[model samples]
Target chain A: MDKYILGKYVPLNTFIHRLDPRMKILSMILLMVAIFMPFPSWTFTFVMSGFNALIIFVLMLISKVRLRDIIIQLRSIWFLLLVLMIINIFLPPNGSIHIIAQSGNFKLYAESFMQTGKVMLRLIEMFGVAMILTATTSPQELTFGFGWFIKPLKKIKFPVEEVSMTVSIALRFIPTLIEETNRIYKAQSSRGVDFKHGNLKMKFKGLIALIIPLFVSAFTMSDDLAFALEARGYNPKAERTSYRVLKWSTKDTIWIILITLFAAGIITISAMHLDLLRHFFPKIW
Target chain B: MQIEFKNLYFNYNNNSEFKVTVLKNINYLINKNNITAIVGKTGSGKSTLTELINYFLKPTSGQVITDGFISENSTKLKFKVVNKLRKKIGYLFQFSENQLFEDTVIKDVSFGVKNFYPKDDGYEQKSKEALRLVGLDESFDSRSPFDLSGGEKKRVAIAGVIAYKPDLLILDEPTAGLDAQGKKEIMDLFKKIHETGVQIILITHDMNVVLEYADEMIVLDNGSIQKYGSPKEILKENVEKYNLETPHIYKTINALKEKGIVLNNVTDIPSLVTELKKHG
Candidate 1:
């Protein structure tokens, strides 16, 4: 149950952990935009992904986030990766300029590898970007960061603060719900729910037994949490004051400058079709 | 059942960066025929120890032996043995009312009985008897447990547990979150069940309940047992030093002693009053 690391925050005082939450959010967006930059050439896409992966790798090292945790989070997208590979293998999207393997009418194309690798790497890059943001920044910081970003929307009656609070509260509930599910599973299993060896019908019965009670508990907990929020003076559509006044430091300005330049470099390189690896290794390309 | 813990150590997540040892190395053999109370502050691994006994949790090291059945970290316990062990010991978890899911109270109460005795035709009768013992009447049998009050739902959940007639009952904060009246009723219900030859081991924060009901007490602090003895014997010691406030009756006794009126064995109000009357 603890294996998941998608929205879980690890409390470690590191360089990445110390960065302003707003800066982290901004950096993640810049990197994601760079990874998905408009580059039609397969080689360029792969090169861009490599750069994004390198950035993510550095973040992981600095944040001391474990690879195993990231890989476990990445497992969710493995099936889509597999499906992309399977589809691309039979029907190459990049063109069958170089035939890698052929059996009867079935043929493997080198270009298929290009397309699959491009997509697979981008998926991993994006997942890594999100993971880095969530793992380093606690939900409270993330909520405040998000609110900082959307503060302008409050002028248009967007309920910006409420949205941020809802998002952070939802993120917080993920682990609580997981723990609740585990407890319910243990409680039911002890009552002889035979989930392991039960037949299909028996398993269905066991699932119903679990689901109803879990819903009840979840609802009960949500009510309690709502009451707690109310007791703490959380009101929707009310003028709220900031509890944590986190101001951006010089470090945040430096991060912004670096990320803007990186974004510009990605756009320039993609527009110029300057994929140096493909340019040097013509035959390999 | 002869329960023994042999140097048991438990971590919720072992072999991980987030590893936290919940139970430390300790060994104790529970005297089989006592109403044992395991009391500790929150996060002191009180619930973990009870879970270990029920085989719901496997220790990270050493072994937990209940009766002749043994659960070890390195080995897989057979389902037959696990099922047998679980049936012989009914566990009433904290917020047990949340475990209720049946459409009606009777079916919910009979859940455990049905599980352990699917072949027995008298499971419904057993459920009714259990409900009666918990002070819920026949009208409650048809009502949805979820529709009932919180205290009633708890009673229904407890009834489900005792319907199976386990050799031992393990309660984790059975009376927690209840009103004084509700707490008294539930504790008295356990006493009635205990008289039926079922040994009870409860994890509770209620020192008064421990003094009034428990025959043996284990004081756990930071995953280690600091004292193991009868309630009177252990509660007489410096309990506050172990992250526990002294029970109110004990505080009263001490205050009277300071006023030159020392009382012995006066751990409860009734006993203190009786002792005071006798002294006069």
Candidate 2:
């Protein structure tokens, strides 16, 4: 089983990896808000791009995660890019003659191209920031951060400990579940169940045979887990203590402040519609 | 409970062209309250035989009867009876980590017990006692099982089965990758558990464990029973014929025999050590 999917936290002593997870999570949200702020002018997009590029460059240096590795994670969302591009081609135009028609009415429209480019860029920025956040934060740190963030909800009688426990278990089992599914697939295939040699409907029905056993095994595992938990004398009502504490340092505060300022600037510029900001922006190509 | 397989023959996916005939005409009787070690190389139907005892795989022909209940040849017996029979037998996997899925060690260990005895009143207490038996402290109950070491994880898995309090315990390679200290701890735990009167059937290739713990040993070869007798008798007579190596003590005795050093039977390490003292 490859342990890479649960963020693969390499535990480097770099600045970004050492940053408090709570601040890093807050910064991630801020980055997303900055990227999505509505803007008719292209300047905000250029500024957002510059900010994202700086983040990627700094994160790569701190985490030492190869650009190729991050790009591999992006490949999973390729279908979303295709869908956005198709939607862009049919979207209503804004009186711009951006379409270039070539022989026999085959045309490439500027509005569609620009819309697709903007959507793709935004998607990449959102996912890239998320990937960076996860790569730098260990599973324990992320769970503790979640627990800390939700601590205040205890006043409202929320089950924060239970919620965090569930989240941590889910995170831990994601790789295990993937391995189980692969094993079940191979086991069935070995017993003369060909998963790929059938028509659409036949293949769909065949998948049930695979899925049923997997579900059965998962239920068995869950039942076992419940028993193990009870045997360990776990009390859901008792207050839980963590082994690792989430400490917010000076560097974390600086990171949070910088991200907040960057987000505020983007929102303020978009609101004001400044002419100087509009001229320096690059047109969507 | 006595487990007996009479002329059992099994082939997986029998109707297909790629069918694998795993076992054929196997005959064996595992006596109750005694440790039986099944030794075989890979693909010798050892796993298949154990699986048959649990009814995980039914024989194509012949019968697997255990504790006066027919487990595999259930055409004559009802399904409910077979289920009742299986509830008495606990099967431990080779890779113990794969069986652990609970968030905490206690919960993972109590999984089998909860399944078998759902209506029991003191389930929680039983679970705690099982964990204690496995040498895990109470402080570890609430901790995430993912944080546990490999040997600890294996112990937790064993604790799960132990909590069920089954009549028969079947373990497949329980000490595969443990260090010397870990192996001793686990083997001693097994010995303590066995002394409490539960029948233990272990499948292993470790001759040292077989010599130390097993009363009877069965050697499997190419889906057939190659040898079956008391461990001492088999080790004394035909250790070389079966291509199975004896323990170091047995090899030393044999070496001494070639050198005209006459000694009474030295079957185990301790006995050999005592005999060497006589010469000194």
What TM-score against the true fold does each predicted structure earn? 0.89, 0.52
**Highest TM-score: which candidate?**
1
Per-candidate fnat, comma-separated? 0.48, 0.00
lDDT tens readout by residue for model 2, B233-254: 7777656555567777777787
User: In each prediction, how many residue pairs overlap at the backbone (N, C-alpha, C within less than 3 A)?
Assistant: 0, 7
| Candidate 2 CAPRI assessment class | incorrect
What does candidate 2's lDDT look like per residue over A1-285, in tens digits? Answer: 222432665556677888999998888888888777766645456566667667766767676655666567667778988888887676634654666654565566766666667777777677667777887888778888878889999999999889999889878876678778765553333222345654676466447645764665677678898899999999988877778777888888887898898888878877876644546643732
User: What root-mean-square deviation over C-alphas does model 1 reach?
Assistant: 3.0
Give candidate 1 regions above 4 Å deviation: A37-48, A110-114, A194-197, A221-235, A278-285, B16-18, B76-81, B115-122, B245-256, B259-280
lDDT of 2: 0.74
Off by over 4 Å in 2: A1-13, A43-47, A93-95, A102-108, A192-198, A201-206, A275-285, B1-280
Worst 10 residues of 1 chain A by lDDT: A38-47
